[model samples]
Target chain A: MPVYSEKVMEHFQNPRNVGEIENADGIGELGNPTCGDIMKIYIKVKDDKIDDIKFKTFGCGAAIATSSMVTELVKGKTLKEAERVSNEVVAEALDGLPPVKMHCSNLAADALHLAVEDYKARKAGKGPIGRVETPEHDENEHDLLEHA
Target chain B: MKIINFDHFAATKMRPEVREAMEPFFMQEYGNPQSIHTLADEPREALNKARLQAAELLNAAANEVIFTGSGSESNNLAIKGTAFARMDKGKHIIVSKIEHFSVLNAVKALAKLGFEVSEIPVDKYGSVDPMDVKNALRKDTILVSITHASNEIGTIQDIKEISKIVHENSGAYMHTDANTSCGFISTDVKELGIDMLSAAPHRFYGPKGTGLFYLKKGIRIMPLIDGGIQEFGRRAGTENVPAVAGAGVACELAKKELKDRTAHLLPIQKDIVSGVLGSLDEVYLNGHPEKRLPNNLNFVVKYIEGESMLMWLNNNGIMVASGSACTSKILKSSHVLSAIGVDPALAQGSLLISLGEDNSLEDAAYFVKELPGVVNKLREMSPLYEEVKKKNKV
Candidate 1:
């Protein structure tokens, strides 16, 4: 049997929104270097709806296919509607991945959820990550001060 | 469709002549070799001839060769049987990190059986260093198992040097799995100072269900199979007479054609490898350039998955395999790749294309012609490639 469904190969060969959004309102990056799978999901929100969504994935065919399918499934949907998209829904949209590639489906769903959480955090003015704080110049930067 | 098969590491088609040699034993003279009957006499003679042929190929005595069910069974017999028999002397065993799954899993099983298993590390080219084997050896170490050549990267080990260390430095029995190396390289067991050698007949165009297990004279190993006396009471069962006869003929042919086959296979490998590496950027060969087998070509193409590349290759009528045979559908990278310290991401992109008696320069050309477009397609869709480009721009 073929390891992938025809739809999975289709999405893999022609993945949609396959680049980074320069100013994405919400971004989610998840990876496990041990398994060599990494994915980033980006969303542009407008009026509590996902106006635009894209992804960048560095993984197997299943990962790229799921990323493409997840983007197609979530675009123009309300936040609540987008949040309803599960790994099963994404995998089903792609005619189902091999049981071995089910983890790739998890990568798709988790990345989207992380992005949504990032969006919620930004809207609450408590952005959780992606900030580089300016370092204060100190003479004792290389040396530890004596603690009391 | 014309299919170009480069998965010889996985299996090879049985030679027609060898099949013809075996055809009679399947039914006409089919009998248990051990039974004392008219039907049994032909099978017994066939078994003896098969053993002799295998012995001649390895330059060993016919008595030393024991036919087994398959290559993996031979390995299991060599490692586990040896360890179990010699447990009174020691409980420790040493094996190379880049051994085939049979050896690795056998070692793992020994570990659970309370044996101390030390997996010696390999070099960057996936070749086991003799000195590393020496260092891993201890007074209690009973057996040391290493592959003659890697099935993944095809790096031929210096078994003569390593086995010398095993025999001289300690009382350990030295074993090598020569399944992939049998026809591709010289596997004179006596010359290599190897105590035990395992080889599968199908690897050299023989039928499946047959393999060779050679143990040095006077070396005792406990039987993995406990039944009626067969294979000198080492392996016990009704032997598959037809397959065994085929293996004998195949071994004889492999020995006769060893030099010719190597001469024919090397150019085909070099042609494909040079074509792939010349045209592709961010790609590198997987094993030692000079120390590899004649027909093995392994390369890693960065920023894409091997499964994806395999799908595209299959579509183009090219048959090859990735490092990892998917285990339970998880795309785990090969242990051989991990042992060589390849980046996990790049290891996921590994490809192994092993040539056999049938491959040619034309097949290599076809592969080179079709590969670039497939690689390009995958890379264009890869975010890793985009990141690499952006980084290079900076």
Candidate 2:
């Protein structure tokens, strides 16, 4: 069996904040179709502060626990504070992640950053940013012609 | 409630009966099977008896079964041996996209040797279409190798149908890697129309180092290894007597318990499938619903990575595999998942739970009950979840 830290497992078994905010201030969806880890972050901001945070992840357990821990760490923080929450901080919060699973924490952090950024963008009347385009490779004709 | 554990997948708890049966092999009957002395006769008799027992399980003659160091070696022998021996006849081979790396990589090696290979595609459920095999055939195609059941997705292919197709079209030899299917499902080489079949004892509660390959009578394949006259000169090197004996016992036990064990696994599999999928929205099943192995459950949870979930499951004392257990170290998604056209996001989140005979309904219940909470927690910090929600405007 793969070795996991007890704390990571505990958080996974009894996750802190689950489900989505009904009228979330901003929602962030970050998924690299190429890589397969998809994360959706939901946040409720009130008076320029995060009043609620929740998530629904469909990946590995570390990703789930990392996302769960992120919500707890960022709840009640201002949007800027939440943006400052790094993947390092999340990994540290979970004790540590295996080298291969570090990407899961990174995804969690990126999803959080994207969600907060989306909120700020809407608040500034700039609206949400459009879908970010992934880097392109020309060697594969099928891939090039796919999005085109 | 009892505290649950997940380490069972890595190593099974030995049953008292199995342990008792293996006791004499370690000391009292430790003589070499190849030796002719009186002391060696006991071990030799035991070895031959085990061989016959193994053959009986597969419905083949004892001489037809050759022991190998591992399932991988057996697979290598089947593919490489056939390709090299029949090069004068043809150099073309056929396999499904979802085959284990053992089969796929062997084919690749053959390709490097100027042999043409055609990889047949599978549907979303990982079932290979026999007609695709028929269409991909060429007059020069010498072998059609397909796995009896998929290791990643748990889909059982119709080997009989594919074997018939190969025989009718090109008269090519039909082979199957039955490592993942042998004991849990009935295997009759002749009935299935298979000319070659490979199996690993560890997959059926036997020893890890013991494996078998069956080549029907009149079929000639070159030996990949060269040395002594072990295994009728088909394979070389001293036999792994103890492991082979253990494998024979495992096969016998599996045969005796197949009915009860299969029935026991069904509910656990059903619970896991229904519990996790029912609780989570947009989750998709990766393999066939009904045609899956009795003890296997595979799912693609959208937006999350499988590695992360596996780590979390590990933390919770619930051990399971994600994607191909062999390819877990690689950052890339499973080739099996990719072959089935699963979306990359969902594919990364794929989880494979292969239940052993010992796994219980309670284990399945606990896993299902806790899975959604884990998914939700991951999503709470996800930017992708937020974006999708905003786009949906709910």
Model 1 pairs whose backbones collide: A100-B329
lDDT of 2 by residue, A1-148 (tens): 4355777778777777777778677877665455544567788888878898888765555766787889899999987898898988998898887665664335777888888888888889885764443232122222324333
lDDT of 2 by residue, B1-394 (tens): 4434433333444455555656777889888778878878877776787788778889999999999988889899999999989999999999999998899989998899899999999998899999999999999988889999988788999999989988987878999999888888888898899999998777777777778899898888999998988888999887777787877787777777778878988888888888887899968787897898887777877655666666656556777667621125455568898888876556666777788767788888889888887666555545566667788996
Candidate 2 local lDDT, residue B278? 83
- The parts of candidate 1 lying over 4 Å away from their true place are A128-148, B324-331
Of the native A-B interface contacts, what share survives in model 2? 0.54
The TM-score each candidate achieves on chain A is: 0.83, 0.80
Which digits, one per residue and each the tens of the lDDT, describe model 1 over residues B1-394? 8998989877899999789879988778877888877878888898899888989999999999999999999999999999889999999999888888899889899899899999888889988878888999999999999999988888988999999989899999999999989866888998999999999989889999888899999898999999988888898888889999999999899889999998999888888988999999999998888998998888888887787788779889999888632321434578888899987668878888989998889999999999999998877766678778989999
True A-B contacts kept by model 1: 0.44
lDDT of 2 at A63: 64
TM-score of each: 0.91, 0.79
